[model samples]
Target: MSYIQQSFSVQFEYKVFFTEKIFDTANTDFANFLESRAEKGIRKKLLFIVDDGVTKHHDYLQDQITAYFENIDGFELIQDIIVVPGGEASKNDLQLFYWLVNTLDQHAIDRHSYVVGIGGGSVLDLVGYVAAVSHRGVKHIRIPTTVLSQNDSGVGVKNGINYHGKKNFLGTFAPPAAVFNDATFLATLDERDWRSGMVEAVKVALIKDAGFFDWMESHAGLLTQADPASLQYLIRRCAELHMAHIGGAGDPFESGSSRPLDFGHWSAHKLEQLTDFELRHGEAVSIGIALDSVYSWLTGMLDADSLDRIIKLLKELRLPLYHPLLEIEDDQSAIVAGLEEFREHLGGQLTISLLRAIGKGQEVHSIDLAILRKAVNMLRDKW
Candidate 1:
C-alpha cells in the first residue's frame, strides 16, 4: 500500500435557546443569534420555510418575521417565506422535497445563506434534508414549534424523510447551525397533539431518569391538563437527556447497533407507517413502550412492580397502550416485520433496548416471538 495517512477532526457546536414569541422584536434572542453569525462585509441571506399548521394558528407569523428581521443589522430575510403542509405527509411527498429544493435554487440559497425550518419534527426533517443536499450542504436553523420536535428530533443531528412508506428511510446526519424552541407555539397544539407530545418525556424518563419518572407520576394530573410549567419542565428535561446522549455518549451519529436512546422506537416506527400515520409518533411510541415493558417483564429483566408503574404512568398520561395493527398474527405479520426492518436500519445486529429497571435500559440481540406474543396479549387483555 502506497497511501499516506489521512486524519482530521471537526468540532460541531450549536445552542438550543428556549424562548417565547421568538419573532417578537422585544425578544432579542433570534436577532442576537443572527448578529453573532454575521460577517463583516457579507450580508447573509435567511430563507424561512414554515409549517402551514403553524401559520394557521399564528396568523400574524409572516408579518412578524418580516418586521422583526427588518432591524437585523447584517442579514437580509428572504421576502417570500415559504409555507408547506406539515406532519408526516410532508416527509412522504417526494415532490414536496424537490419543490423546496427548487425554491432554494431559484432563490440562490447558497451555503452562506441559512435555511430556517419552523415547525414540528416532520417538517424540520424535510427542511433539513433539503438543506443538507442543496449545494452540498447549506447552513440551517431550526425553530421547533411542537413538544415532540423541540424536545427530541429538532435538537438532534439527524435529518430524514420517508421513502416507500418506510420511516426515515432516506436521511442524513446534518447538524443545525442553531435550534430555537419557542414555547409559545406549543400553546396552539390541539388536544391530541398536546397529550401525545408528552410521551417522549415519559419514554426518556423510563430508560434514563427514574427521578424524572417519579416527578411525572406525581404531576400526572397537571401534565395531563397541559399545565404550562409542567410541560415546560418536561420539554427541557427531555431535550437535556436527548442532547446529553447525543453529545456525551460518543455516538452522536450512531455508528453502532446499541441505540439506548431508542428504548421503544422499534415498533413505534412501524406502527406509524402501518397506521398510515394516523397514529402520532408519540402515540406509537407509547404503545411500543408498553409492549417492550411487558416483554421485559416476561423475560424476567424488569420486575412486575416496575412494570405496573410504567403502565400506570402511561395511562395517567392518557397515551394509548394498544393499537389494532400492533397485533402479531404470525411471522408474516406487518408489525413483526418491523423487527427485521429495524435491525436492517441498524445494520449489524438486531439490537433492541429493553427495560431492566425503572431508569436502566439493556440492549438485546434477540427476542422470543412467543414471549412477545404473550406480551401483546397481556396488553390487549390485561391492561
Candidate 2:
C-alpha cells in the first residue's frame, strides 16, 4: 500500500477520470476499514482465500493488516486456505467449488460476514461468486494485485468458475463493495503473467483510445519491462475502458441483447475453451481482436491498412498470433466450428462485432466463413 500521495478517492457521481485513485490515505484506508467494520459490531468469520501461489508468498502486503491490525476487535478473523495449483487449474470443476462452499458453511459464514479476495483473477472470480451465492449473498471486497485482475477482471461485477471445458461457464453479476489497488504488487508479476495482462490493455486501446495505442507503440520496449510509471498508466487506462462499458450498459449479463464490452471476448472466451485455457485470457483477446479485425475486413467493413496495423500492433505486444493448441484439420471448417461457440455464447445469433476502422467497430450478422478462413490462415502461419 503506497501512500496514496493524493487524497485519492473518486465518486462516479462527481466525475470519473482514468487516473483517479479509489483510496485516499491508502496506508490507513485498509486498516481503518477493518476497524470500522469491527466498531460497527460486524461479526461472523472474515475468511481470506489464498491459493498455493499466493500462500507460498514469501511476502504479502495484506499481512500488514493481519499482523498490525488483527486486534481491531471487529470480529474473529477466520482464515481458510485453499492450495490451488494457481492459474486456470484453480477454476476447474464443481468439486473445488463445493469445497469452498463447504468451508464457508462449516465456518458458518453469515450475511454479516465478509470474504476478502487477495489474488489474481481466478481467485477473485471463484471467491467472489462463492460469496455472492453463499446464503444468497455475502459481503466481499477485491484487492486486485495482478495487472490482468486490476485492468480487466477486477472492475466488472461478474464472478464464476469455468465448467465443462468452457471458460466462466457459470457466473452471476455481483459487484464488490470496495476494491483496493496496490501498484506495489505489480512488482512481483512474472514476465508471462505481466505480458498476458498487457493484451487486454492493448485491446482497450484498440477499441477506445488510439492515442494510447500510439503511445504504447512508441514505448513498447520500455512498457514490456514493467516500469512503474508505464505500468501504473496502463493499469489505470485499461480499468477505465472496462468501467466505462460496465457503467453504460443496460444489462450486466448476456440476455436479450449483448453489450459491446464484449468486443473481442466473443472469440476470446471460446478460444480459451477451444485451447483449454492454456493460453492466457489476455493472449486470447489479442488473438481474438486480430481475428475480428480480419472478419471486419472480409465483410468490407474495415479497410486494409487498419487490418494490417491491428495485427502488427498486437504483434508488438507479444501476444500469440495463434496457438498450436487451436490447430484445425481444415482452417475453414475449424473457424466455422469456432464461430459456432461465439454465436451460441451471445444467445444463438450470428451477431458479430467487426472493426470498421481503428477505434471504430460495429456488430452485424452473418459473416462469411471463407473470409474467416483466410484470416485464420494468415494468423495460423504465424504460429
**Among all candidates shown, the one with the greatest lDDT:** 1
Candidate no. 2 TM-score = 0.86
Task: List lDDT for all candidates, in order.
Answer: 0.94, 0.71
lDDT of 1 at 258: 79
lDDT of 1 by residue, 1-383 (tens): 69989999899999999999999999999899988898998888999999999999998999999999889888889999999999999999999999999999999999999999999999999999999999999999999999999999999999999999888889999999999999999999998998898898988898899999999999999998899999999999999999999999988889987799898899999999999999999999999999999999999999999999999999999999999898988878898899999999879989999999998889999999999999999989998
The positional error of residue 206 in candidate 1, measured at the CA in angstroms, is 1.2
Clashes of 2: 2
- TM values, all candidates: 0.99, 0.86
Kindly report which residue stretches of model 2 are placed more than 4 angstroms away from their true locations once superposed. Answer: 1-26, 35-39, 59-65, 79-83, 325-335
What tens digits encode model 2's per-residue C-alpha lDDT throughout 145-198?
A: 678888888777789888777667787877786677767667767788888888
